[model samples]
Target: MSPVVIPARIKKILIIKPSAFGDIIHSLPFLNAVKSTFPNARIDWVVAHGLHTFLEGHPMIDKLWVIKKDQWKKIGYLKSTLNEIFGLVKGLGKEKYDIAFDLSGILRSGLITLASKAYMKIGFEESDEGSPFFYTHKIKGGMDNHAIDRYLKLAGFIGCDTSSVNYPFAPFDNHSDICNILPPNYVVISPSAGKPANQWPAEKYGELASMLPLPSVVISSGADAAIAERVVKFSQGKALSIAGKTTLKGLMPIIKGARFFITNDTGPMHLAAALEVPVVAVFGPANPVRTGPYGSIHRVIQKKLPCSPCYAWQPCSHWRCMNELTVREVFDVVKEMTET
Candidate 1:
């Protein structure tokens, strides 16, 4: 595909990447690349409602178009959903964007790209749900590459420097309340994942936390409170449960100040990596090479089963990949990490 030329007049730009915290973090380097190349351009992002808090005051982005994707998906919200959709299209059409990038690569994001009425629309050639059809320009974003690298390929297509991966997140004031409760020099553990198959057992996490040298602070959202509680319970008071207490913005400081982090394949795992905290990530059905913690300092623990890296959404009958990983194995990695 031919490279996209940003005209001299190009000013306002729209980036459509709506949900999932980890994917949003992966897209930050791309945002950095775009902003670095076109410093004067007004960069806007369409982010999902709950996740928009992270980007609310972002320095690189001029506007954040929050979409209530979860609320719209509810069966009872038919009328409201239609109104919201039409309103979004109408509002976006008025922006007169010079360029729009569909980084999410889903049907909804494709529609959002089309609705932007931008002079140039760009997206991945292999985007799912025929989303590539909406793009005026398409770049080859490899499936095998890390999500961060795949996103950088899009920036490269737009003549942005992708050589250096940087996350240009705006500075955040530390949530002193969170800090006050957390023990000094503690390890943060996020033992829950979006998919059940990707999660290592909560009891196993408890076992690992109990053996750690430092006090373990178990973090969890409202949805994952049960999992966090189980980890705390099984730890026999070794780990403290801080579930449903902090916001996404508040989580940065907690992770940034962490001695190290331990988690399953989850969003907070990515958060820890972005914060430059050393991570000990446990992998199961998901492929660690593609989506695991990024950076040289982090460690990934996974069993090398013949059917490993299965990338399955549903639970397998045996689930030998996660079942086979022992708490001792994870503790050993943590011990090694802390020593250095």
Candidate 2:
């Protein structure tokens, strides 16, 4: 489809991408590109509640339309969820945006694009759940491309210069209060994955930590504390668990200061990659080509199997893709990275 012509002066803009840490990290370059393109325009974002904290106080964005999306899933909260959605639609319509980009390309995001009532509604033709029908303009965001590249394609489509790919995180300090409890020098291990299928065994992570040159620190949400604790318990005193101790913003300094990072295909792995921290990312059923660490300074470890990259959020009875990958196999890469 042919693109809509952007107005000569775009006074206000809306960007729709919410939730999940890795995907949000992928969108940072697009945010940077658009900010450079429209320095004078007011740019607002529709971000989910918890993830909003990560983008909170972002320098490039003017206003954040925080939504209670996580709460929307609870049947008990249906009334409140509907009320919040109503407020969101009415408040967004009031913005009178010149352009709105639906980066997420989903049913919920499509509704957000429609609610904005922007002069130019842009999204990917490949967006899921019939979301493309809602957009006035559609770009071909190929699924094969890295998410960073895919998001930048939208920036290029919107007349923003995409020559420089950069992750402009909001200003954060180098010191974390939780750092006080951490070892002076440690390798950070993110042993838990959002999907069980994407995870390597937590016990194997502990075994790997035992072999590392420095002590290891485990990070996770309170929900995944069991996995984090399992890693610590099996580390033979080579690792410490700080799960549920730090906020999202607090995580930056910890990742930034780590000697190196070891993780499954999860959000903090991307954060580590963005911070230029060397990462040894263990992949299971997910396609690393599309969602792996973005830079050259990363090593991805996955068992070579035809059934791999299945993206099975729910693990089958025997998941050899991750189950077959031994701690020694992962340690070889970690050792090589540390040596070099």
Candidate 3:
């Protein structure tokens, strides 16, 4: 059955997108689209705790309800979780929202939409049948389309021009005045991805670090300092690894000031692209079209093996596509992008 559209009189909205840092960042444009259409509408987002830091005080969002899943998933804490869930539901019910959007389109998002109990629930038509049952309207979304455009289409269906993708964090400067501390022309090298196969070789990153025209700093997950150590060792004094040194919030300022960024397809890669910094993003098993950095000053490297873009989350024993790429190829692309 086709989704039932609600009236334009709808003024309150609840949007749910829970995890996967890159996807959450990508969903920002959809939120902006809805805001553009209904400027006076009070928009609320349901997200995990740390993720809210990025969305702190967003003009498009009137409130952010942080959902702690781990706490809810604990065995002995079921009652506590229920209480928290009840409170969240009460808050949403109090808002008297006319429309709720399950942009995440996952089981978790579906549950959140149900909890909101809004009159009109919107989500992806391609989502699990059980999930869509909770939604009043469903927009088409999948691999053939860019994720950003797919989300925007949902807003468009509800009268949002959401024609443009906006990065709320790009214009908002929450950094210290120590912008002078950074080198005049520096390149940000993020040698990290959620999965190992998507990551370029540490030595290769080091080799590229040695070749780039400007000073370089390596970014990594604080929990995994060994990766940064390998990158530094391979770079032979050409790289400075800042793993375990900066919090997610602290790193944005560094990325914002960078002249350019080179990274494996990762969250920071998207962040850099959104910040309008030129990026040379390396891709392997993942489809760059659906999830690559979205910006004009960007280059995506994919070898296109018969098994290319497998989207495998686990470490691949033989990552042929990534292995085939040489440091020189990436350096050349960056040089070309920066020079012209």
Candidate 4:
């Protein structure tokens, strides 16, 4: 495939992958390639407000444009939201980015691409919500590939080297306050998924945790604390709750401390994968090929059914895909991955 045309001098580069914890984590390798390829260029990123904390103080990225996405969606905040968006557009327009890659293939991201007036706006050809139309160059980011590889294809398209994939995470302190409360060594359980369809039952997680040799620390965002708490409740004192206690940055050390990670297709699962923490990723409707724990050291446990990879937004009435996936099945894999 012919590479996107390069400007004589590539100066300012923009990367648009605004939100979703896992998606942003997956983009780190792409960021690595871009920085390595254009070491001198000033690179900037557009990230969602709450999630921006994860990318905060990233040395690889020159600046962060925090988008108040949740507030933007509310009718009550329309005026402020518009003003914020307009200011963002106006500010980005002044940068005259030599190249911009919309890693996110949604209409909002597409609009950001248009607003930037990038010399070359790159996005996936199969991007949903007609996001492809805004791209000056559209690359076919194959659906079957892992999210990392799919993102790398775009890197390769823009002349960035994809041979070496590395996650450049922002620095986090292992000795922070949250870490003080954690057990000397424990397994991390991210007992929540953004979608109902992807989640393995919380009680199952507790069962798995109870059987594990190491103590388990259940974690989640403030909103998802109930799910984490449910897992802890089922662990019968074998697991403890650290949910809502740590920020995105603070959680890194906690995960790093884990001997292994057990999660139900959540963002932190990707984080653990990136951190080289052996992960037993439970899957249901979501395709592990596209978004499971990425590295080879990890194990993916799923109840194989023809309807799997359906990528359902909500669990079907029966929801056998997840319901039938027993705790023993997942625990055995975890033991195989960790004990062996």
Candidate 5:
């Protein structure tokens, strides 16, 4: 394969990274590199439904094409799903993009890349579900590298300066109404994880929250309301449950003003890290090296069990990785972070 050379007259580009909030956050630095290199380019992103709000008013992106991914997955909505897919392809075909990058290396994203009708399509060489077949250019995105670094490698392949990693998010306005309800100098605790194996017990989170120097504000999506309620209940009135209340945009200011954050390995964890809030993340099944808090200031608490970081699809029978991590251990780390 010949090296990817950015055309001097490059004008339009599309980035296809559809869903999963944390992965989208990981792609920001790559977006920054491309936008920095081609300051005048009209960069568009194909984001998934519900998750597009994070990048809705981002400075670097010119357009955000949202796809209804969840809606399309419903077996009952076959007709609408087909219509959406075909309509999206037809619309993308009309855009005439100069280049398209498939950062989300999956079959669906690969199809979107092909549909864009871009002259140059770039994707990972090791992309699963035969996603590489549609790529005009394939870059070796290593498996073991941190997600942010792996994405930057693609920027380097396209001759962008990858030396410095910058997350160029627009400043979020303070949700003063939300802030007014909470105690000053509060700590945000995000106890939900995508995988059950990655989650620390809600009772454990509550215990940790109760021990913190500041008041704890527990956040949760509508789907995780039960878990959030359990955390608040277990806190014995020490923590406040604001579950199902804030939108993605609303959550930022809450995190921004937070003294520090405590979370399971999840999307909000990445959000807190992006906001430069001090974070104490608890890791279990997943490898923190690849997807943990990125910066040096944040702290990660995980057990050193040999079977830890298993990355399992099913919940572990014992779940010792998270179960064994004591509330005292997490509380101690939070205390240390506050002092610093």
Candidate 6:
């Protein structure tokens, strides 16, 4: 039997990606591509409340719907949370979305997809597991594709003709003074990772910061201030730690202006890669082959420990994978990236 042809009549689309900063960053190009293909379409995003800051003033997003997990998890908060969820569903229904894509492919997003009244609901196949079973159109063959490319392919199923994934970001206004302070040819050294297992030694990054000829800025999520402080201290006053100073939206302008970015395989690494900034990413625990920066102009440093890419639960005791990477090796890559 011939597959059912989804009506190309999709104008109002809801993109459901509700967690992880890096995954959302990876999805931005696909979102941008959707707008490029359907300029008239109203593109609404449903993301985690924590990441709402990143999309606050994005020109292409027609609406930003957020799900606050923390508030919803409290014992007495069920009624209010459900009401909020219902309100989101009603608001989404009023927009009359013709299509909703569950890009995050998780249970929470599955609930959101089920709640919405869009005619077409799409998500990943079941074998990916942990995925909610609410999609009307489930696309196979995503595991082999790069994460960004997978989103493009999903867009294709919706008639988006996503031939190219391009990300055009709006510069945040508040950081102009911060940008001025950075050297013209500086590299951003992002030393902290969300999980301890994925992080290289902060002392090593501080050591590397001191060796670099160009002035440097150290970045970390506000949650990792201790590590950020260590990098700043290790740089011996050569580096500025902007870890807790900038919100997600405010950091883009700083990243866009940097000459190069050195990071763990974290969200900003994906953002820098998406922005076309040169990147030197260090990888361990997670599979770099699956999630490393895609396209040219990016370099990755990884040691081939036999137990590397172990995908350990965070804060593993036996983390020689990332620990084996020395400051000197990462510095060599940073020098190469800056020179070329």
Give every collision pair in model 5: none
| Candidate 5 Cα outliers beyond 4 Å, as residue runs | 1-3
lDDT for each residue of candidate 3 in 114-227, tens digit (9 for 90 to 100)? 878788888888886478877877778765777787787787877777657896652355674444555677888898788877888888988888787787878877876788
**TM-score of candidate 5 relative to the true fold:** 0.96
Worst 10 residues of 2 by lDDT: 1-10
Give the per-residue Cα lDDT of candidate 1 at 257: 93
> Candidate 3 vs. truth: CA RMSD?
2.5
Better of 3 and 5 by lDDT: 5
Compared with the true structure, the alpha-carbon lDDT of candidate 3 equals: 0.80
- To one decimal, what is the Cα RMSD in angstroms of model 4 from the true structure? 1.2
Give all TM-scores, in the order shown: 0.97, 0.97, 0.91, 0.97, 0.96, 0.91
Candidate of highest lDDT: 2
Clashing pairs in 1: none
How well is each residue in 25-67 modelled by candidate 2, as lDDT tens digits? Answer: 9999999998898888999999988999999889999999999
Error of 6 at 239 (Å): 1.4
Tens digit of per-residue lDDT, candidate 1, span 167-237? 87766777658689888879999988888899999999998888887889999898899999999988878
Residue 223 C-alpha lDDT in model 5 = 97
Candidate 5 residue lDDT tens string, 147-260: 898889888887899888777775567775777899977889999888888888999998887777778999989899899989998887889988889888789889888888
For model 5 the local lDDT of residue 196 reads 82
Report lDDT per candidate.
0.90, 0.90, 0.80, 0.90, 0.88, 0.79
Summarize candidate 6's per-residue lDDT along 18-121 as a digit string, tens digits: 76888888888888877877788788889888788888888899788988877877879889998987798787778777888888776777877777777888
